[model samples]
Target: MDACSPVLVVGALLLVLLGASAPTVSAARAFFVFGDSLVDNGNNNYLMTTARADAPPYGIDFPTHMPTGRFSNGLNIPDIISTSPACLLSHLGEYLGAEPALPYLSPYMRGENLLVGANFASAGVGILNDTGVQFVNIIRIAQQLQNFQDYQRRLAAYIGEDAARERVSQSLVLITLGGNDFVNNYYLVPFSARSQQFEIHDYVPFIISEYKKVLARLYELGARRVIVTGTGMIGCVPAELALHSLDGSCAPDLTRAADLFNPQLERMLTELNGEVGHDDVFIAANTNRVSFDFMFNPQQYGFATAKIACCGQGPYNGIGLCTPASNVCANRDVYAYWDAFHPTERANRIIVANFMHGTTDHISPMNLSTILAMDNTRN
Candidate 1:
C-alpha cells in the first residue's frame, strides 16, 4: 500500500492506459467478476481441471510471487481494474470499505466477504454448457448462474431479500465469456462436434443466440449494471501463432472467428438493453479491437515481443502451461503474453485501462467510467 512503491509509481503512468478520466462521482461500489481464464482470479484453483494456473511461474510477477490461478504472470484484468484509481471501486466511500471480491468456491469466502462481492468465474468456461467439457469439472455458464443464485440466497439470509436485491442492482458486475467457445470448443478438436454441426458463419450466430439467454438470465437475477466483454484477439495469441502461423503472423481463421463474434455480441447487448428499457445497463467492452491494437503493434505499446509467450516451449514458446520447466521471461513487462492463451499482467493492465474509460470504439455505448457515474447518481 505504499504510494511510492515501484508498482505504484509505474501505475501512475499506466493510469493513463484509458487516456483520461471522466467526470468524478464518489460512491460505494461492490464488484463481481464472472468469466473464463481471462477474468478469473482464483476460482479455477478450487476446481479439478488442467485449465488452472495454481503453479510455478503463473503469478511470478504478482505481489505474492506465487501462483493464484490467474492465468497470468501477475495480476489479471479484474485485479488491475479493482486497484486502478480510474475505477470507481478504488474510490469507494469509506463506509463501504474495500476488498477484492472473493472467489465463490473458496472455503474462506464467507460472512462479510460475501457482502463485498464474489467471483463465480471458472477457467475454461464458455457461454454454452458443453463448451469446456474437455476440462471435466469446469463450471459452465449455466452452473455459474446457479452458483450466483445460491450466493443470492446466502446473501438474503444475512441481509434480507430487499437489501440483497438492492446490493445486486447497485453493484458492479463484470462478465468475460465467449473466448473459450472459440479456443476450446469449435476449434479444440479439428472438425470438432460444434464445427461439424455448423460452419463458422452459422456457428457464430448460434453462439450469440445461446449467449443471449445467459445475459437475459443475469438480468432476471437483478444485475442492472453489467460490463460484458467481447473475446480478445484470438488469432494473435501465442497458441494460435505457434500452431497455425509459422511465420509469426496471426492465424487468419481464428481472427475471422473473433471478428464474427464481437460485432454480433455488440448488437445483442444493445438489443438486450433496449428490451430491458435501459440503454446503459449492458455495456460492451470491445476487447478484440483493444487487444488487436497491442497485438498488431507490440512495440508501439512498449512490448518487445507479442508473438512469443513469456512461458511454454516449442514454437512461439506457447506449446503448454507455464511450469517450472517452461522458458520464463526475466521481465514480463516487455512481453504481451504470459502463456499460450493469456496476456501478461502489464498487457492486462492496458486492457483494464480501456475498460475503465476508453471511448465507444473501445467500450461501446459507454465505458466503465460512465457506468460508475450513472450508478453514483442512483446510490
Candidate 2:
C-alpha cells in the first residue's frame, strides 16, 4: 500500500491511457485570478497608478526579498492559495501542482506561459468602474474581463480552439471585489458622488446587482469554478480605525457597510448558483467572519496586535501610505495588518487556510479541497 509504489503508478498510467477516469489521475488545472490589491500579485507594477506597491519594506518578506507589487509585507492571498509553501494548504498546492499565475499584462506572459493561466487583478480596482477613480491608471473590472477574453484568444492560437476552451472551462477562478466600492468611492470624501447618489442601504444592493452581471459574464467566458470572496472586516482595518475610531475600536459606519453587504453578497452567489443549476459553480468565501477571528483575537492567532499595521505612520500606523519613511515592523509575523489597508503575509495565510478547509459558515456549499476533489473525480 505504499503511496508511490510501482503497481499504483502503473495502474494510474493505464487508466489515463485507456481514457478511463480515475480519482487519482487528473490533468493539471489552470488558475485565473481577477480583482483588487487583496489578491493582486503584480499587475499594478505595469500600470501608472498611485496604487502601486513596488517599493521597499513591501516584499521584504517575499522569497526574492524584493518588492513584487503585492500589497503585503510578503505574499498576498492569491499567492498563498496558488503556490506558497509556507501556507497550511501546502499539501493542496502540491496536489494541484499549482504555479503562481503571471500578471496578464507582464511581458513574460507569452508562448507556453499562456497555458498556465494569468492574474488579471489590479490594485484599487473594484466591481464598479468609478470605485477607484483617484488612481490615475488601473484596470477596472470591465477591462479585466476584456483582457480575459484576449487571453483566451491568444490561448486558442497556441493550443487548438477546442483545447483552449477546455482549459478555461476546467480552470479555478478567484475574484475579490466590493471593498473599494465602499472605502475608496462611496465614503472616500464627505458628500462623495456615490454616497450622494445612493444611501448606504441602497448602495449595497446596487453594487450586488452589478456584481451579479460580472459573475454572469465570467460564466459566459467559460469560468466554471469560481471562488468569490466577500469584503473583509473593512471597519476593523487599521485605516478605518485611524480615520473613524477615537478609542481603538472598529469604525461603526464602515462596519455597518460590511454587515449589510456580505450577507447580500452570499445571497446573490446562492441565487447565481441556482440559476446555473448546480450547487457548486460559485463558492462564496466569508472573508469578514474569517478575518474577524484574527482581527478581534490577535493573540489566538499568534499575533501581538491587529490594530497596528506593520508599515505606515500616525495613529495605529494607519495613516498615510507605507512609504520608505514610514515605520516598518522588524517582524511581520506578529502583526496582522501590513499597511493601513492590506494584511500581512501571515494573516493572508490564515484567511486562505479557511478557504481550503473551512466549514459552510466560512465557505458556503463546499470548501476548495472538496471542490478540487470532486472536479478531479469528474475529470
Candidate 3:
C-alpha cells in the first residue's frame, strides 16, 4: 500500500490552514542537520574518507553535473526539505530572507549566512562513535554535537549570545542516523564487534538508549523542534538485496532489524516528548515503512525495479561505489536507487514530499507541512 496518499485525507483542515495568510517572521527560523549520508550534503567532501561521494555519475542529474558530495544523483532529503514551501525557511525567505544552510566545515560559513543554519552531517557516522570506523576522518554524532556547540559560539560572536540562542531554539532540526548503525556497524564485516557484543534483541535497546543521549544533547543545544527520522528500508536496498537475496526479495533479517528499530524509535520519541512536556518538539518520521512502499511496489512509484541501482556493477549494480566507470542508467527517475545503497534524487524527492505531507504513522504527531503551517498560523 502507498503509505503516502498524495491526496490529503484531512482536506478541510489543510484548506483552512494552508489557505491562511502568511506570517511575518519575528526571527528567521534556522535549520540544523545531522546524520549519515542520507542527509549529508557535502561535509564528507572535506573529510579524507573513502565514504566520500564527490565524483561523476554520482551527481549526473545535479544541476552542475558534478558531485557536491551528496549521495544522490541530484538533491538529498535535507535539500528538498529546506527548499520546500512547506518548510518555515521558505516562508521566511519572502522577507526575512532564506538561503541553503552552509556545510559546517566550509570556510564560507562565516558572517550573516550563519543565520540560515548549518549542515553538520557526515556521510558515514552513526549514533555510536564506532559505527563507521572504517571511514576514518568522518565526524561521529558526539563530535557533531560538539561542533554544534562551536557553531553557537561563532554565531554569538557574529550576532549576540542571546540572539544566537533564540535562533537555535526556534530553528528546525533534522537528524538521520540509525541506518548506518545497522548497515555500517552490526552488519559491516560479519561478526562485527557490535553484533558480537549483543544479540539483536539486546543490541537494539542499547542503540535506543544511546540515541536518547544524542537527542537530549540536541535539546540542550536549544533545538526546540526536531524531525527525528527512523531508518529507511534497510533490507530492501539494492546492496542488501544483492548480497542476501537470490530471488530479489528483501533480506528478512535486516528487515527484522529495521522493523525492531523504527517502532522503538517512535515510542522513544513519544516518551521523550512527554518528558520534555511538549508534544511537537520531537516528531518521528517512519521512513522505513514509507520507503518500503516504493521498494516493494516500484512500478507503482514509476520505478522499473527497486532491486537494480542506477549506477554501479555486479548483481543489481550494487556491489561497490558508483564511480565514473560504473554502468549508468539512461533514466534516473525510473530507478529507485542511485548507487548500491543510496536512493536516487527522484526517490529522495518522493520520500521528502511524504515527509512534508504524509499522515498518521508515516510521520507521527504531525507532518512537516502541518508543523510549518501551524507555526505560521499561530504566529
Candidate 4:
C-alpha cells in the first residue's frame, strides 16, 4: 500500500437515504475491541457505578441519538471500528459474562453485519485493580482479559484448534485503556490523600506488569494479531487539568507518569513479540506523542481550545457528570472534548488516522488494516 495513497479503506458508497455522499473504509474482517469508556457501547448496566452513559446527551449525534452506554455525545471508538467494512468480528467485554444477557450488537452494519463488537470498557476501568473502588463494582482490564480467555475457549471447542487459531490469527484485537488508572489511583482514591506518599516510578511497574498479563492472556486465547492503543494525552484531559491543577501547563507529575509508563509499555510489547517468537505480536499505537504534539501547540492543529473542554465547569473541570442540563455543545467536531473527560469525535478521528498509519502508538506497529491484511496470509 502506498503511504501517500488515499487513506480511504472501503467505498461503502451505499447511500443513507437512497442517495447521499458517504466516506467508506476498505474491506477487512473481524474487529475485537477492548478498553474503557472510549470503546464501550453499553456493557456497564450490570455494574453499580454513577460513571455511566446509559443516559442522555451521550449519543445525541449518533444514529438513534441514544445513549447506548457510550461515554460521549456520539460515536465512540467501537462504532468507528465497525463502520469500516474491513472489520469481521466485533466483540466487547460485558460483566457477569453469562449471568447477564449478552449486550445487543448494533443493527446498521452492512453486507454481513461486520460482526459488531460489544464493549467491555467499563467507565472507570484502569490498569490497576483498585481504581474503581468508589463505584462499588466495575470492570477492570484484568477481568476483561479473563473474559477473552473464556470466549477463546468456547471458540476453540466449537471450531477446533487449527481453524480457531486461524480465525483468531486473522483477527484484529484493539485494546484502549489506562487513563482511569492514573486518575483513580494517582488522584482520586486514597492516592489523592497520599499525594507525596507515592511516586510515578512506584506505580509504573505494577501497571506494566498487569498490562503484560492481559497481553499474555490474549495470546494464550488465540490472538495472533493485536492493536494496543496507548492512553491518550491524559493530563491534557479537561477532567484532569481543569479542576485539580489548572495552571495551563501540562501536569509534569502526571505527564512524567505517562512518559514512564509508555516506554515500559513499549518495552513490554517488544518483549511480548519476542516471547511469541515473532515480530508481529502487536502494534504499538503511539497516541501519547500525537496528543502531546496537538496539546502543546493547539494553534498548529487549528484547535483554539486545547486545555479546556467544551463540556463542563470546575477543575480539569470534567469534574461533574454530563446531565441533560450540562450544557452540551453544538459542534463536537470542532472541540477537543465532548465532556470534560472524553475526546470529541474529530479528535478521535485524527487519532484513528494516526492509528491507521500503524505507528502513532505502541499498540500497533502497523495499522490494524495491515494486521488484518496479514490475516489474509493465514487464511
The Cα RMSD in angstroms, rounded to one decimal, for candidate 4 relative to the true structure is 7.9
CA lDDT of every candidate: 0.81, 0.86, 0.82, 0.63
lDDT per residue (tens digit) for residues 1-379 in model 2: 7644445544543442243443321245788999999988899999888999999988887655678889988888876677522122332245355556678888867665676678999999998999899997999999999999999999999888999999999999999999999999998999999899999999999999999999999999999999999999999999998998899889888899999999999999999999999878999999999779888788999999999999999999999999999999988999999999999999888888899999998998999999989988898
Model 1 residue 204 lDDT? 97
Q: How does each model score on TM-score? A: 0.90, 0.91, 0.89, 0.79
Error of 2 at 25 (Å): 14
Going through the candidates in the order shown, the clash numbers are 0, 0, 0, 40
| lDDT (10s digit) by residue, model 4, range 1-379 | 6322223211221232112333222233445667777777666765667768888877776545667687777666555544522211121111111111123222332222222223456777777677766776777777787765555555557556675566556566778767777877676644463355556687788778888988888888677767787776777677767655747776666677778888888888989999999887777888787788668777676677667676666654366887777766666666777787787666676666666554534335567556545655765
Off by over 4 Å in 1: 1-27, 84-97
Q: Which portions of model 3 show Cα errors greater than 4 Å?
A: 1-27, 84-97
Encode model 1's per-residue lDDT on 1-379: one tens digit a residue.
7655656634542433223332222233667788798888888888778888899988787655778778898878766665433333333212223455667887756565567678899999998888899899988888889999999999889878998888888887889999899889999878999999999999999999999999999999989888899988998888888889878888888889999999999999999999999898898999888788887788988999888999999899979777999898888999998899899988887887888779999997887777666666765
lDDT assessment of candidate 3: 0.82
Q: Write the candidate numbers in order of decreasing lDDT.
A: 2, 3, 1, 4
Q: Which candidate wins on TM-score? A: 2
Candidate 3 lDDT over residue span 37-80, tens digit each: 99998998998998899988777875446688899998788777
Q: Per-residue lDDT for 359 in model 3?
A: 88
